[model samples]
Target chain A: MENGYKLSYLDNLESESIHVMREVFAEFEKPVLLYSIGKDSSVLLRLAQKAFYPGKIPFPLMHIDTSYKFVEMIDFRDKIPAKENVNLIVHKNDKYIKKRMHPSKFGMDKCCKFLKTKSLLDGLSSGGFDAALGGARREEERSRAKERIFSFRDQFGAWDPKNQRPELWSIYNARINPNESVRIFPLSNWTELDIWHYIKKENIEIVPLYFAKKRKIIRRDGLILLADQFNSPKEGEEVEEAMVRFRTLGCSPCSGAVESEADTLDKIIEEVMIAMNSERENRAIDYETDGSMEEKKKQGYF
Target chain B: MHKEKDLLRLVTAGSIDDGKSTLIGRLLYESKGIYKDQLTSIEDIAKKKGEKEIDLSLLVDGLKSEREQGITIDVAYRYFSTQKRKFIIADSPGHVQYTRNMVTAASTADLAVIIIDARKGVLEQTKRHSFIATLLDIPHILVLVNKMDLVGYSEDVYEKIKEDYLQFASRLPTHDIQIKPISALRGDMVVKKGNNMNWYDGRTFLHYLESVNIVSDRNLIDFRFPVQTVIRPNLDFRGYAGRIESGVIKVGDDIAVLPSGKKSRIKSIETYDRKLDKAFTPQSVVLTLENHIDISRGDMLIRQRNVPEIRDELEAEVCWMAEEPMEEGGEYLIKHTTNTVPVILKELRYKIDINTLHREEKKELGLNDIGRVIIKAQKPIFFDPYVRNHKTGSFIIIDELTNATVGAGIIWYPSATLPETENSQ
Candidate 1:
């Protein structure tokens, strides 16, 4: 992996991603990137920056805030606009909270739909954004493993994995009708290893939860669950002390941490490099149903 | 250090249950691409399934349902690298119903590795896959006759399948179709040359994969750069962003911008930090032009003498992928390179039969059907022929109502070639 001439796996991935981002700008009338305050989204932002170097990103950044994210992620998000000097739009499910929305009341899928998908869709409808670039990778799950670089969505933002537009060569179909927004995945071909390698190579900043930490946690369903506001354990579940770190980040209720001592990004990268289970394994919502993830995608879950 | 390994984009096709997933799994496993934890999890799953041996299929069958069903239901991509080449294999399903998946995977593939069962010599599915490989114009084709142990490693059987394939492939426009006999289950003549096929003289699967000629597969003649976006920094810098579609671009070369018909000289080509002296296909770079023009997206840059045609009407051979047949009045979003323009089907030409390579007169095309049609676009687009240059010639048709990509099209006659006649029209 000499840093010259050669297109390393990461380099090719970046090139492909940048190319896709440019296509989004070229083909769509209005495009925005869904930036979850995570490393993958950060890399996507950096790639977007590179794709339009010497100019600001043409589209604004959209973040579907669950209102239960880590404080560190929020703090970092606050400073990013000033650092990058780009437009950022934060969409929160304020209506859901006003309606006394809780995951326990309607289950994980409905909660995700309201908090994440509905918020994002509400933002898009208001802003008239036609395309939303995401940082989803196929290696995350089985149904996702068959995704194309440019994935089409219906007017309601539903995805039918069975029938997708065929993407051939460099030609990407980014066209969408009125009220229909396409979700462009720039990192569709990238794997977790590729993301880590790029993060290390580029020295990208990420949330602190990714590193090792000693926190009050509970072990249930063969997972070391992080103790967050929404995940305080049911009456029957037990709480325990565990030195755990998150492999992925989301709403604290659904996102779980694995027991590990690796605190630094390098150590975390090494652990993830050799870890056998998929990244989404620790996600509580995916396993709630047979194809809950796919079902959510059908209803416009990013 | 030895020259950095080149990228090899390959696609695998075979009949369902012909061990396509197993072969891909073995290749990735043997190449050290699968992490240790992934291997362990697969082993655990294989054990739970009560298999006598650890099933290699578990390595790639990522879907839990696909695992329970004991079949690959979708196209899964797996990447691995050796000292010589970095391989991206599209592990597509082999069932006849999933033929669309195989075609989608093979469209961008530089080569197609068609796996066949030695016990079943030259099945109908094999011909279908091979015909697709030819139609897609994959430069290299490697036919792997697997399950040789079942056939007792008989050299005559290998030759028969090879001969049958060669005879069928001869009818199609294919180049460099090589035959190899191996057992995907036994791992014979796959990653390594085995002793079972003593009389076989061809290189092993991995050896051939690493050594196959792909540099010639790219079109290096016409210089095409479709401007993706324009970059004008408030920080007092100017650059035009685009990925090189084909050929090479260098500093101080005369270039022409399409649609607007403006000419300028390339002042510099920049990546992230530094300026590049020269750039070629697939490299996304920002170019600073000698003169500032009203250039935006949907514009192309090329050498003035070797420019693509700017035309409004197009004759294209299209692969209709949507369940609903293509109609004359329906509008689609036609995407070529970085440009997306709405187009309407002007006339139905003829559909080509994949099995017999014959043209059938049809008013509409169904799913997985390839046909020639005339289309009219709202705006004139610059393009080349599908055979001459893939980057500029290829386009996708997205259904306006469903927002689904319904067809993949290749320009048969570009408007750029008939610029004078098109201008008068």
Candidate 2:
């Protein structure tokens, strides 16, 4: 522990990520950061800024607004571009919004497809981005454990799991065809605990929804859904106000909340250390089947 | 606040049914790295498969095809930490067809954990994995003779396997080797010391992993920095941004930009957190020079007196990854450090037979074939021997047509003494 001359695990992870960020900036002609406005995205943004300090971020930040996001998330997302001194591109599927696509009306699968996946593809294609940097961590899920840091995608944004390129040492192969792209995950080696520790050490700002608060919620299928404007109580469903916080942020209807009182960063870290369930447990999208995330990732879902 | 823990990356390679997955699973489970929900899902799968006990291998075989086949297909990275160090396990398949995946895992690993079944002592696959572990210059190798309970925890059996392995590995270059006995299924000697193996007295697998000395594995004596990009925020501030691949750098140190032969003194070292007086290997920072030097991406910076070899021809060992066989005299892209240039396969010297460690004359290398080849680059590259520095001595081969990483190579050295025009068919 007295090895001050050597870097800690956190410092090493940060350095590795910064290296990746700079590589993406140098290797790709047109690259963009897929900002999700979640804790991971917030950390990723800080890393990007650190990667290119004393200078503006070399690429624009793109967010796919599914329209069902929490009001606080949207507000927080709107304020980042100005504060960070970077360009932000918010891609919303206006056609689907006009058609009134909702998870409650249409299924969560279809809603996620049109609102998130399709919008993401359209934004990237229209922007002519050859590479997209994301905040995906391999430790987050099962199938993600096998994903390479520089994940290659076909022209249609489909991931071929069986044909992953061999990533050796610190050397990355960023070469791709004109229409094909690569998903650069700088945070592939970081764990959830490492992320929280980093956020605490750097004092990075995050969405207030992560902290505990009194919010109206409904229990459905063992998941606590926020009973907000986008989602209300159904017939015979009781609406209750409780101290709940979200482990992950996504479309509010699809992301579940867990009951907790860890409002401060320290308390949240403590709870996370002793928590029983994994972070992705509350995510309803992963509950459809055994390899749902794999299926989604193959179809260009990030 | 807590003290920062160091990191160790290791790879586990073994043939099918060597309890590789179970051993990894046991380590994770016993260390409390496995969460409740993951265990529950595994239990559900185990019940559906009509198993009385939960299958620990299910935790690592994440993909559906892997589960259906009951074998690992590609490299799966698993992370876990104890109080002392953080570990990243590159779990790769042991099938002969997936040797490329094992090479990928070993490329960044400081240690290699080779699992061998005590019942089947030192098989050809074990030799293959050992040869690769040594060929890639892994600093440490721990051979775990797993399934000891199935072999009645016999000391003679363990010793026989260890002796056989030592005999085979005597010719390899890796000097740090440790052998132990364990039962992944019964949870013996993996994390906690079980009572069955009383005669075999040594550190358990987890204890050895936690306490191994890997600090000196990095090359800290030679400074090598390859500039990834130039940070030019404004006209007044221009800096070279890159990660120090090896050695260290400090303020006022005399440095030279490679291939350009321009020299300058370091003015300052800058990072997002704060300006540092000095920095070491693997740290990404922007460095400013006292004198203006024309340096951009793909340019290397090193000490003025200490420079790596600069040559356009290279003799190296290559592991072919693509399904299609290597085409003789084919042109491909060679990506080394931050530099990418056109390269041609000059000659295929020979391919090594993994089973016998014999060199065979071959014209082409197919998938998962290991061979020594001569390559000619369009431009001179600054590099050291792979044995001297892993960071600056490695490169990846990219197929020009498909953009796939067709090969992985470790440089022997600059082949300047070899005849340039002596082409052998």
The CAPRI-style docking tier of model 2 reads medium
Runs in model 2 deviating more than 4 A are A1-4, B1-3, B414-425
Fnat values, candidates in order: 0.50, 0.78
Q: Which clashing pairs does model 2 show?
A: none
Interface RMSD of 1: 3.5
CA shift of B324, model 2, Å:
1.2
Residues B1-425, model 1: lDDT tens digits:
11245778899998867777778878877876665555666667667769767777666665656667877666777777777877788877787445577778887788899989888888888888887777677788899999898999999999888898888887876477888898887889988777898898788899998888777667666899888777877646678888887888889999998888899999999887577898877788999889888887778889989978778998988888888889876788887777778898888788888777788988888888888889999999888876668788788888777667788887886534544432111
Cα lDDT, all candidates: 0.79, 0.90
Q: Using Cα atoms with residue i matched to residue i, what is each candidate's TM-score against the true structure?
A: 0.88, 0.97
Candidate 2 local lDDT, A133-173, one digit each (tens): 99999989889999989999998888888888889998899
Best by DockQ: 2
Point to the candidate with the largest TM-score.
2
**Chain B in candidate 1 has what TM-score?**
0.93
